[model samples]
Target chain A: MVQLDDLDRAILKLLKQDARLTISELAERLNRPESTIHFRIKKLIEKGVIDRYTIILGEPLKPKSVVAVYIETEIPVIEDFLEKYINHITKTLSMLPNVLAVARSGRNGIIALIGGETEEQIEKFVDDTIRTLPSLRKVEVFPFTNIVKGEDVIGFLVDV
Target chain B: MVQLDDLDRAILKLLKQDARLTISELAERLNRPESTIHFRIKKLIEKGVIDRYTIILGEPLKPKSVVAVYIETEIPVIEDFLEKYINHITKTLSMLPNVLAVARSGRNGIIALIGGETEEQIEKFVDDTIRTLPSLRKVEVFPFTNIVKGEDVIGFLVDV
Candidate 1:
């Protein structure tokens, strides 16, 4: 089990906001010695607490509208094909750039986040591509009108 | 409109994978001169194409179970209170550490991603915190059995 002290949590919080912060900058902000900050960061990475450094894209690259499409496939008589069918759907959805994320819910369901230029476009894509897929029983689209929390997710998940 | 040529897109893609990559490292990988890579990165930052550098926490800090909860509120007769009611709900959910993301869906709906130590904990949270809220028409929970794409989202959105 990994136990994080107050200092570790604080360092993580700061890095989550801006990983580019130098050891000196982190030390200044946290009121700690630069060497201490450096050593802690190294340990965190080694322990697999800090996975990797990355970037969040800006508005220019993000889509104007976004929606989460939940699709539940009707169970087939064969039963053995359920996993294959789900895999196919997930793989096909994963290939599309507009589909930011794809996940399986239970044995017969798939949930995906998709983005487009407008609400109409997203709806159309869902209707044309997702709904038309075979064996799907339910397709629900939840439009993201305004994100109050974790608002930058679209930017983080958007493809360059 | 901002236009991204092949070189700009390539640089952005590489940086998205590893923002900590040095200019020389990026140049080496992209087969471009170090100076050219530096100049392009500078311009990308200036143009707001590269929003900000950040970090993704590893699995140790991320929740073991995740779910997307979709809640739809019943439209009130007064009509004017819907916005306030929705805003109040979103703000409240946003304050909780377990609620990873909150987004408004149309006028009467809100979608939230939540995380917990176990599936039972997440269910209990929804039953206690979400379903008990007034004027809710529907509450749907989609458990993430397997994430095929954007799997690190929970780690990225998890609070320190």
Candidate 2:
């Protein structure tokens, strides 16, 4: 586990909320010296604790509807073929703009977060693009009606 | 829909990768004047196309294991009670630090992203925290073995 003192955790929390904060601003907010704030941030970055700085696109760019799709591929006679097929599915889904995130679940299952302008549009995408794929056992779709926490994730992961 | 020109998208794409890029750097990369880059960025922010700036934590802070949990609550005789129960469940789940994201899947269902040190720990958390909740009809856990796209989301959403 990473050893993070209260000061380090405080800085991290502030940065997570707003990465654009200047050293001086952080110093003032955290009641620390500017030099100390600068040094700590530099050390954090050097230690790989601060991975990257990025922007989250707002509503103008975000999809109106989002869904989580779980896909389970049928186990074929050749085990090797299943591995290759799963890789292919993940890679193919990753390239699509609407497919916000993709991950392998267990051995034969895959999970994806998809976004679209409307529920019907996302459903159509699943039917035409996902369901049509060969050698699948089951595909379950979970629609997100209201996001209670981490709602900004859609904005964070949306494509330009 | 908000209208965005190619230059706006180009700038957004670059910023998404690295928000710390100076206006001059963006201008050099996009082959535009620094003043123009500055003006465009200002306009984008004013229009709310560019949301807030944020940081993604590195591996040291990210949970080693993540799982997507789908929870469905049993509908009660009173529809009013169902709404309150769903709200209570989502709010409770959202309060937990390990529950990275929570969203209402439907009237009676919820989907949450959970993280922990190991898969066994996460499963134990689910068993102790989630399954014990009253009026739950089903609780499904999908362990993420490999994340092919938007993997940084764990880093982005993980709490300090």
Candidate 3:
């Protein structure tokens, strides 16, 4: 297991807020030497902690409906099922093109985010996207009434 | 940004699979010494790379029809509404207790995963849990047809 100290905690909190922050900027925020921040980040990469640095794009508000999806399936519950089916589902979902992020839960369901220009457009988008899934038994799409938080990914990691 | 080598990528991929691995065990898999592995993890922690350790709990295959919800809502076109509503939506969705994950694609929509024991049970659960959101003006529910990728957290991150 990895152990984290106060500085580490602060640094992570900062990065969670802004991964694009440069080493000098991060060090300045944490009141540390730029060299120290750079070295620490390097070690973190070597240890497999920081996976990668990528941009999180904001979707076009062109769509008026924000949809929330819940899923359940009837698969033969077994390890072989997990090993074989996991890859297929992952590939297909990743191909959604409009999907923002897909995450796993403690239950046998997936949450998907998609966008469109209107209620009908969003509905059609949902219909077509769900149809692309092969083993899916049932899927529910609930368009969001509102999003209280977006783009901010650190909420789960810390108390704001 | 942290510069990564192949070894660093390997470490990240492995740990992303399972964060519960012991330092010594991680070293064996990475073909590195325990001390080196330990140091790398420490450095990663200090750099805010690995956020924290957490357990993903999936309910023991219960008897509910999984529902996927898509929410389309209105947001300020010029301003950032992702954080405002996303936070609120996440808070509400999380409060449902049955909700596993809530994800959004900016202002266009929010995708949420919810589980229950039966179709009716899931329906009631959604009605009781989500109907109260003040910002949500409309909603659409799609019972999962088949899970395409289910939850691909590791698959989304790892090369293997």
Candidate 4:
């Protein structure tokens, strides 16, 4: 198990909010000595408790409309063909810029997050790109309206 | 539309990868002058193109299993209760540490992302916490087997 004390968690919580905090600022905010704060951060990084830093794009780069698509492909009799087909579809979807995220649900199920400038555009993409694929047994599109929690996730997951 | 040229896109892409890069390093890597890179970043922030700086926690802090739950609530006879009930449920779910993301899918539907130590734990959470809620017409849980795209999203959204 990952053992984290109160100090470690406090530092992580602050960093999670703003990664640009310097050692001095962190020390001041957390009421810890500068040396101790610096050492703790170094240890956290070394232990892989703090992953590599990255940036989240803002609204200017985010899509205006988003949809979560759940797709289930028909299991071919060959069984071997099922695995290959699933891999092929997942790889193809992952390469698209509009597809923000994609993950396999089960044996033949795939869930994808797609974004666009407008609902019509998203619908068109789903029709042209997703529905056109062969061997699809089920496709359900859930339109995401108001994101009450994790509202910034769209900006975070969007590619530059 | 937000007008961004090649230089702007290049800088944004690099920053998205690593926001810790200094202006001089970014200019050197992108073959632009330091002054130009500095000005561009300043403008980007002013234009709200950069959004905000944040951190992604490492695997040590991440949950071992995650699932996306889709819920549709039954419309009540009162009609007025629908909105209030949905809001109540969403707020309640959002407050839980295990519930990572929550959004209103439609007028009577909700979508949430939940994480736990194992599949059984997640299942128990859904059954004990979510399934027991009143007015729920349907509940579907989709386990994330393997994320092919936007893999860092989990770490990025996880709270410290």
Off by over 4 Å in 3: A1-160, B58-65, B72-92, B103-110, B128-137, B145-160
State the local distance difference test value for candidate 1.
Answer: 0.93
- In candidate 2, position A75 carries an lDDT of 98
Q: What share of the true interface contacts does candidate 3 keep?
A: 0.02
Q: Over 4 Å off in model 4, which ranges?
A: none
Query: What is the lDDT of every predicted structure here?
Result: 0.93, 0.95, 0.55, 0.91
The full ranking of all candidates by lDDT, starting with the best, is: 2, 1, 4, 3
Candidate 2 chain B, run of 10 with poorest lDDT: B151-160
Overlapping backbone residue pairs in candidate 2 total: 0
DockQ of 4: 0.82
Return whichever of 1 and 4 wins on TM-score: 1
Model 1 segments more than 4 A misplaced: none
Give the better candidate number (1 or 4) by lDDT: 1
By DockQ, the better pick of 1 and 3 is 1
Could you estimate the TM-score for every candidate? 0.98, 0.98, 0.45, 0.97
User: Which scores greater on DockQ, model 1 or model 4?
Assistant: 1
Give the Cα error of residue B106 in candidate 2, in Å. Answer: 0.7
Task: Give the DockQ ranking, best first.
Answer: 1, 2, 4, 3
lDDT of 1 at B139: 100
Candidate 3 local lDDT, A12-122, one digit each (tens): 556645564778998988899998898887766565555544322122112345454555555656858854564555566657645544543323455565555565776
- Give the per-residue lDDT of model 4 (tens digit) for B1-160: 6789999999988887887899999999999899999999999988888888777888998899999999999989988899999999999999998899999997899999999999899999999999999979999999999999988888887876
